[model samples]
Target: MNRDKVTEDRKKLGDFGEEMAKKYLINKGYTICHEKFRCPRGEIDLIAKNQDDLVFIEVKTRRSLRFGEPFESVDIRKQKKMIKLAQYYMNYYKISQVNVRFDVVSVLLDESWDVKEIKLIENAFY
Candidate 1:
């Protein structure tokens, strides 16, 4: 495939993965608050209400795990950015005294781009 096609396909895969992640969370009783929440600080994949707590999620998806598990990609730098974004989100919404948490939803896909696995890591980071 050409570079442009590759990029487009990759984006499509990401969109599909995000949609799947949102549906999975909803099925688990989470109320979707935002998808692709972005600002100058950073981008949040998904933000939702998991019962009483506000949940900030990072959804990572891969068709192959030759590098490592999908969640393993959320390195320290990314975590820090996400943290900052989460704080910004809270402040922007004037959310106070509400429990908040970070989560990682790893999505594994097959060669055909069909979801093969979905793993939710709750309380993934402080």
Candidate 2:
């Protein structure tokens, strides 16, 4: 396939994963505060509130484990970026004096684009 097509497909997969992640969080009693929150620096897939703590989430999706599990992609560099975005979001919204946590939701999809599994890792990083 062409580069453009590949990029588009990846984006579609990401969107689907994010939707799945959102639903999963909701089912777990998390109140979703935002989706696709973006700043000049970067974007976060989802933000939620779990009781008194505010949660910043990253959703990683994969069709196969050819590379690794989806959460494996959240390396140090990605974690740093997520921290920056979370800070930006809190500051932008004047949110303070609340506990904040980072979470990773990994989605695995089958060949037919059906969800195979969803894993949630809370407090994934500082």
Candidate 3:
């Protein structure tokens, strides 16, 4: 495939993973607050509320793990970016007086585009 096609396919895969992640969260009792929330700082894949706590979710999806684990891509720099995004999101919405946690959803897809593995890591970061 060409470079543009490759990039487009990656974006489509990400969207698919995010959709699956949202459903997974809803299945686990979380109310989806936002999807692909973005600002000058960065983009947050999903923002959700569960009980009294606000959850910031970062989704990493992979068709295969030839490079590394799906979640392994959230390096220190990426973590910092997500923190900024979460903070911005909370401040923008004036969300306070509640606990906040960072969660990660790693999704792996099989050859047929079916979900292979979905791992939810609560409090993956601060």
Q: What is the TM-score of each predicted model, taking all chains together?
A: 0.94, 0.99, 0.96
lDDT tens digits, residue span 19-107, model 3: 99999999999999999998998799999998888999999999899988899999999999998888898889998888999999999
RMSD of each: 1.1, 0.5, 0.9
lDDT score for candidate 2 against the true structure: 0.97
Residue range 55-103, candidate 2, lDDT tens digits: 9999999999999999999999999999999999989999999999999
RMSD (CA, Å), candidate 3 to true, equals 0.9
Model 2 segments more than 4 A misplaced: none
List of clashing residue pairs for candidate 3: none
Q: Write the per-residue lDDT of candidate 1 for residues 1-126, one digit (tens) a residue.
A: 899999998888888989999999999999999999999987899999998899999999999999899999999998899989999999999998999999999999999888999999999988
Error of 2 at 71 (Å): 0.2
* Candidate 2 lDDT score at position 71: 99
Relative to the unseen true structure, what is the C-alpha lDDT of residue 35 in candidate 1, on a scale of 0 to 100? 95
Question: Relative to the unseen true structure, what is the C-alpha lDDT of residue 124 in candidate 3, on a scale of 0 to 100?
Answer: 91
Report the alpha-carbon TM-score of model 1 versus the true structure. 0.94
- Lowest summed lDDT across 10 adjacent residues in model 3 is found at 89-98
